[model samples]
Target chain A: MVLLFTAGCRAKVSESPIGPSVQLHAPLGLPPVPIPPDNPPTEATIALGKRLFYDIRLSKDNTLACATCHDPEHDFSDPHPISLGVGGAKGIRNAPTLINVAYQSSQFWDGRATSLEIQAASPIADPLEMNQTHKVSVSKLAKDPVYRKMFTDAFGSKDVTLGRVERSLASFERTILSGDSAFDRFQYGGQPTALTPAQARGLALFINPIKGNCAACHTITPQYALFTDGKFHNIGIGVNDDGTLKDAGRYHETTVKSDTGAFKTPTLRNIANTAPYMHDGSLQTLEQVVSFYAGQGNSNPYIDREIKTIHLDGQERSDLVEFLKSLTGKLPPNLEEEKSHP
Target chain B: MTRFYSRLWLCLPFALVITGCKSSPPPPTAAPAKPAVSYFKVDPATAGSVSGKITFSGRPPARKVIDMSEDPACVAAHKGKAMEESIIVGNKSGLENVFVYIKSGLEGKNFETPTATVVINQGGCQFHPHIIGVQVDQPVEITNSDPVTHNIHPMAEINREWNHSQGPGDPPMHRKFVKQEIMIPVKCNIHSWMHAYIGVLNHPYFTVSKEDGSFTIANLPPGTYTLATWQEKLGTQEQQVTVAPGGQAVINFTYKGRS
Candidate 1:
């Protein structure tokens, strides 16, 4: 009910009570979409951002676009947890799906960076990723008069800055939100036949604080349960390549001793699409992730203090994993728009 | 005689049981206890503040162009808005975002916190105001006003630190200074060059500069204080000044150039 900094468009922000409620296309069960005061989601910004997102020419080699890794068809992920970037270099972490990313707190597995605009730019420069510098990208886009016009219209001035690029990409990303999964009907709406008794029981065990402990991190809010706490935790990830703990995750950046082994808690919605879980993409299946937590985290020194040894029987563990599998939602809206890869 | 003898035996047995119970008591009650309180206070201390402004002295500093990275999907850390420092229009002032704070002293000061923590937004991919002067023990809300995501990474040594990425549409990032330090360096890792400075003081005697490079700290409680200034490119300079109650005392320091 809290409309924070929005102009009512009869969509929630703009429409005054006097105006007819613009046939609200907002998916059932979601907090009002938060839009910044300066850059409210316009038909204009979204169009510009979408154009840039699909444009392969945005890359240094003109071989890939944002959809190259986040193919909308395969549940917004490429199915390969760790993806190949420009020059066919493998990435360090899995290609996380864009479903419900609007609800996330931090972006990367290590959480080294924050904000989508900032997060969008890292890959373009990382040698192992897009491998394109800002200058190279702007110059490449500048070659096309159409893009130049689009950039000018979306950002007022035609002076292409990194800020404009990041803002555009981030705007496109916000449109890729996820909801309306089958499981939601089975739970929230009284569609009793939606889920079998077994899945229902599975949901019960999944929510149990003592046995599952999944809700602590993978939250299950009553409405629009994005299934994430949007916080960071160590979760006892494996040691680093140097035989020392891996990039101290958040610790490497902040040097606050407590963050020594922690990584951002990933969203569980459509987590099944993004395989090879964790920061390093080590775990292969939902079963593996479930079993890892069942073992109360790898019993490592840097493991989070909250990760305690759990005692889930075989049936309970199987049901909990099933509950997670049910979270696989529908493919993103723009999947068809995303060009198919071979 | 029989009744008396029976009562005497029962009394002896009960006395023996009582004696045993008194000799071996529960160990759980052995330790001394303290009252429960939310936070531990260091000492009886009054609230304080720090204020100062940035100075180019003669001319404004030059501005640097911002760059974006080219990493792939999930290649970047966070995808959100830019801070206030990242996208401000012009800064002839060469080096902006000079943070100043007291490095030591002023841990656990007793001060009334404001109803709502103040928000230092990162709009237009830059830090709003470029520089902030805050009293120690005050809370700061680092907000991302831009459509893109931003991470508020504060490099603090004397107090509890934070490094959080603020995504679009997400709640604001709230933080408090439990300890007092002269200055803290705040940065956005996404924008390698995007930086801002915050000056934290134990007393209300700090000010950051407007575009004109004018800083001020008002409402002093009649005391001698060490006032300081910091520049992102230039080092720190401090001077001593005395202010009468309810009166303003102006303090200034000059630096030759970036050290």
Candidate 2:
């Protein structure tokens, strides 16, 4: 029996030794989640990642967790315009929704990180955020017997490293996808009554290049709608009173003058849930965002030329907001937080 | 019999290592390696030429004035004369920036991927030549001459899509498309007004119409070919033309403006 077991273990060493792999449950209307080649998800990895994501031990003071800012009830985003970090330190930008983020070409408003794995490590080390080094964070996890077992089950070893932690966290995030909204059903699922008359009218105006032209950047394709072109643009946002950009945005990453005020076009999948619009999170509501665009986006020298002033009457404005609300979709199941170790 | 059974149990681990641990056959070796093809050379003695003019009929769309007020550098570069290049009509209704190429006829033939790189310069916050063509695997170099930064993004449908930021004084980016994709739309996310198109073909017989709406595809083996002209807004038109040995074929395409 020992020989048989040893033979089995040795035989599967080259294959998936971490048990069976699992597919992400992506709702309809969204494309398949683009998983990294090296970090294929398993049940063990996802469970470990979820525990790590919600654990306050990852922070310096053991007070802040990923879920503290990215609250699950609020569509995996922070309600505050700027997220409060460990020891009450405030972050520079709004906490973007984790829903459908796996589809994004790059991470963050500035797109400084190319992948979720790379983005996962930034907040843990940032002074204003978690304020914890990878070494300390790994040590915290390694000391816990439960975490040691979980890490062993997930990654085939009791030794915990930052790379495995990042891979696991990214794997869990890849599953927090949302899609199959009312707008998606109406547009792709051929459900005529999925949208109200006002929303239908708004959809028409949204696509009309001369009218709303909202789809110019918040794109919708014939097949599926990711609602983002995955490109940065300065739409007159964050312009100060002195006619200069308050936030350099993409410019800081690329050191390009034209990208001075530009920021990534965030996905609009669950736009209603993740409020306080734009990269700065200044706009309080969808109406203000729409109105800002209607006024041709705060006219700075670096503003996108696509932002032409448009006339949206009272009725049109309300309908456009209604259409945006229809974008709120169903969240993935099994997001309930597990009790943390005392 | 007991000795034989003990020996069989010991050999089971090696059998599992041989069969169970083996990888899945390497994906059929990617369509059998493709037969080695020789480079096609144009026989100058029997080579033909296809010269054509792309003309616009009716009223052309008025070029919208580009507002570069936001970027002081772009405004200074164009001297406030920057306009949309979607529709550039020359004298006598000659339509510029139309891509003309042989759509069909030279098949199963391989052409040398041009060693000379096709340059697309970003000057004054706009793509210098709005429309371009290149053979498959031909190098397409993008250079930024503007004082500002420009992110070049190619939204290719059939080919791989890529987006990169290129700042002034940065080295030119070299890229090539392995697949034949027609009219890949390129955009600058930084400057939303900046747009360009690239057409990739397997053969070397392709050219963009000049400012006077003239295009000439020289060095073509004499044969009947289905020629096509593509205008960004006006759509595409196709025509069949037969070229006599060493003869010049004249073909003109007319695109009507939207009524």
Candidate 3:
């Protein structure tokens, strides 16, 4: 895993004579972009990655792409409760938003993958997902002249290796950052009038230890806020009627008993745009999600200690939801504009 | 003694080279140069020990029952009787798992980092010996002996934090903390309830209290030291203790329970 302290360092694309090195500037309230030392974001590589992200050839039967589930228009998250892959294969968990994912310590709800490069390779081979072998995916990309040239431009060689593919995809995903929202203006921008009365009250409860206590896990430092602790917690979601976990979320990967209903904490940035929250996408709206927390989560043995019973009247609940909405921020420029080719 | 003297001779050239590189005098506030010896050696005749009992005065908190039903292997391993180890109180209210160490007074002392590795095993879905101490730069070997995968995550503040997944039959992971951190909390994100604490010190004068609540730091050079004991839930307590040459210093600490 990438060290947490290095995640905030402004990483520049390595000097390359092939293309202009893109200097990724973090927007307000977000920390500097952490570019992998080996996979720096040259314009050629980002362009190649963007083209690969939108290419259906990466999937079997030429139907699915990374963008199919992580839709740029929907805060880079799927609208469905759980994502549907090629051949309508149903996924077990919700497709989490990729916004600000460059800051995450681990990937996937289970956090099985340590790096984004590792994460980008899993779905293409998973039977329920893209259902394509890495070898075949590389072969398909290699078959195209346009892809061959792009690969050469990105990696200084025409060889389309799986490692290069993973790196390029990760480099592109790192640029999908979002920050500088109304909440940022009010909290960090020194503008007290940025938020309405309800949003201001909601922010109060969000940070109040005894009230919302959301800040305990959705951390907000004095300088910036990622809205996530990057730790796993069993918030009592997906519990069966018999008190057994419907899905042994994180435990499937770790085999640790307490991890039985746990999942990685999703960032609350642009949460207003990503509907159907939680790992399972059980609650449809922010109100239901807040109510679930207020109800102290479904009682289970491994539930997080931070999940405490709290009182939030209708007004307070609405204010909290409004405060969450204020978190929706500006996306990176040209993110929504689809590039047809590299 | 001969080997120690030979190692000091081997380090003299490198020490001189380091000093020769400096063009200006060090600031007055700079620390004194470390001794050229490879390691500090305590005189066997003058060496003393600090031993103590960590006791709890009030009623101990009830241990919470752990539900391991999700993993049948874990359930079978514990036979449905696994309990939380947050506050393990034994006979005479002796607190188990309290980390006792020489928190200060060992400054400027360079003890040789032990080559022997500290082993922590994952079995029965829990970390065995939930609290432990290791010298800085000493290797900590973590092994998974269960029929499942285990992820070891050390949330160290001073040391670099890392997490790795270890599956059944996988080779043990050897890691070391480069800096001194009083206590680093470790957790398995996969197993949210599994918790452990690691106390990393530069010196070798640290140990965890056993189930009987007794701890000992042996082979210490006689001196006054700031001794500290840390409990996971009860927090930390410090005291001043002076050990006479060749004498054992006995101390005791008490923690009150919540009313």
What value does the lDDT take at residue A26 in candidate 3? Answer: 87
- TM-score of model 3 vs. true structure: 0.54
Error of 2 at B90 (Å): 58
> Which docking class does model 1 fall in?
incorrect
Q: Write one digit per residue (lDDT tens) for candidate 3, span A200-300.
A: 99999999999999999999999999999999999877765334678898898999998888999999999999988888777777876775676566556
What fraction of correct interface contacts does each candidate retain? 0.00, 0.00, 0.00
- In the predicted model 2, the residue pairs found to clash are A301-B70
Worst 10 residues of 2 chain A by lDDT: A8-17
Model 3 bad stretches (over 4 Å): A1-20, A337-342, B1-259
The CAPRI category of model 2 is incorrect
Worst 10 residues of 1 chain A by lDDT: A15-24
Query: Where does candidate 1 stray beyond 4 Å?
Result: A1-26, A157-159, A240-244, A338-342, B1-259
Q: How accurate locally is residue A25 in candidate 2, as Cα lDDT from 0 to 100?
A: 69
Candidate 2, residues A1-342, lDDT tens digits: the string is 743454445433432228777988667688777887778889998898888889899999999889888889788888898888888998788888888878888998999999998887679889999999887887788789999899889878776777778878888888888779999899989998999999999899899888789999898998878889999999877665335788999999999999989999988888888887788777777866665665465556788878874656546766888999989888877775886667
What DockQ, on C-alphas, does every prediction get?
0.01, 0.01, 0.01
